[model samples]
Target: MRDLAELDDRVTHCAACPRLVEWRERVAVEKRAAFRDETYWGRPVPGFGPPDAAIAIVGLAPAAHGANRTGRMFTGDRSGDVLYQALHDVGLASQPRSLRIGDGLSLRGTRITAPVRCAPPANKPTPGERDTCRPWLARELLLLRSTVRVVLVLGGFGWQAVLPVLGAAAWRVPSPRPKFGHAARATLPATDGGPDLHLLGCYHVSQQNTFTGRLTPAMLREVLEEAKHLAALA
Candidate 1:
């Protein structure tokens, strides 16, 4: 089986979606005004965390100027500010901020990944793009399954994306499907002798949610605390 580092390296070189490849590369060249002088990663963003992590975080996709710019998940962005801070408060993160790659920030017993590796225009990936990216996420989880006991999904998009992957990974998802809501919890039965998995839902820390008070720092921290507790049991 490939290690997390190996999977990450492979994910970085992927150009499966022509539209995503063109868009990511174009953004890298055109550049954002503030980061024009800096180089953009301009490629797929791989999952970030240790291989033995007990908890997994699933997000929608990389922000166009965030992970796509820093070459690290949730780094160099406002959403990251909210997320890393909450993780730190819950004792999952080594630091409260994720500035860029090589920022010395680290996670303990937790891994962060996304359904879509590349940043899509308008922060929204089409259904086809998302479907095309499924294998990467599936492969990532297969490698992490032995250690990952809990999953924290951010936003409805992430919730939807992860459910199917969980089934494919042999976790018995309910037929009706668990609804996606802040603090929603679903426990998937183990199949083929795999470990039982806990799934937790939280609102995405996007600017729209944060700025409008839909998802506050306190709210996020609370959910992380719960996830940590659940992970401990696993």
Candidate 2:
């Protein structure tokens, strides 16, 4: 189950990072007519799913025209359409469509979060911004510390943000540590409990990926199947 109140609290006044604060506020101002009467949270959006979930999907951050507008992760956007379809195929979601936060959809045994909570300009967050936003992820991880069996990183930055937090091993020149890619998996180096945090890397289902035909529903399902198996084992 999820605590709606807590989720609201986490994003209520999130200003741990300044650049994001300025950017979010600017969007709220420039795009007011669309969301004029609405009170845009324009802050750090928290993870969405069951609080006790063992499976988590981490994305880069909210898109100015996507989650940042809809006030829900993966809602009101084309990117979400692709992702939710895959979740439905993998049996993690009961609904095939994610129209909005109140569309009567639910994530079973899974949760979704972002490294940089607020939406950044051009959808690119600076390293300093990402680091400053780490505390939010850390707080969410601690809350989910009890049962995080698997992590699915949507892109390279998502992987980079999560790996260090999970304490995966590091190597010099040779770099024995694996790189992020479709189907890549690495066990945490003893930081997040002994259970292997099956890390599955996949290309983010962005407009570029989907329109370019780089990612198909079938390809997404294959990786999701691996995630399901790992979640079950964990």
The top-ranked prediction according to lDDT is 1
lDDT score for residue 131 of model 1? 92
Q: Each candidate: what lDDT?
A: 0.91, 0.77
For model 1 the local lDDT of residue 151 reads 94
**Which stretches of model 2 miss by more than 4 angstroms?**
1-8, 32-39, 168-175, 189-194
TM-score of 1: 0.97
Off by over 4 Å in 1: none
Show how many residue pairs clash in every candidate, following the order shown: 0, 0
Error of 2 at 115 (Å): 0.6
* lDDT string, candidate 2, 1-234, tens digits: 244357557564778777888998778667646557665656666678888888889989988767776677877678988999999988999998786667799999888888888999899999998888776676676667677778888989998887656552321112465698977877654443355456789998889988988988888888888888888932
For residues 91-150, what per-residue lDDT tens digits would candidate 1 score against the true structure? 899999999888898999999999999999899999999999999999988898888889
Worst ten-residue run, lDDT, model 2? 166-175
List the candidates' TM-scores in order. 0.97, 0.87
Model 1 error, position 114 (Å): 0.4
Native-vs-model 2 lDDT?
0.77
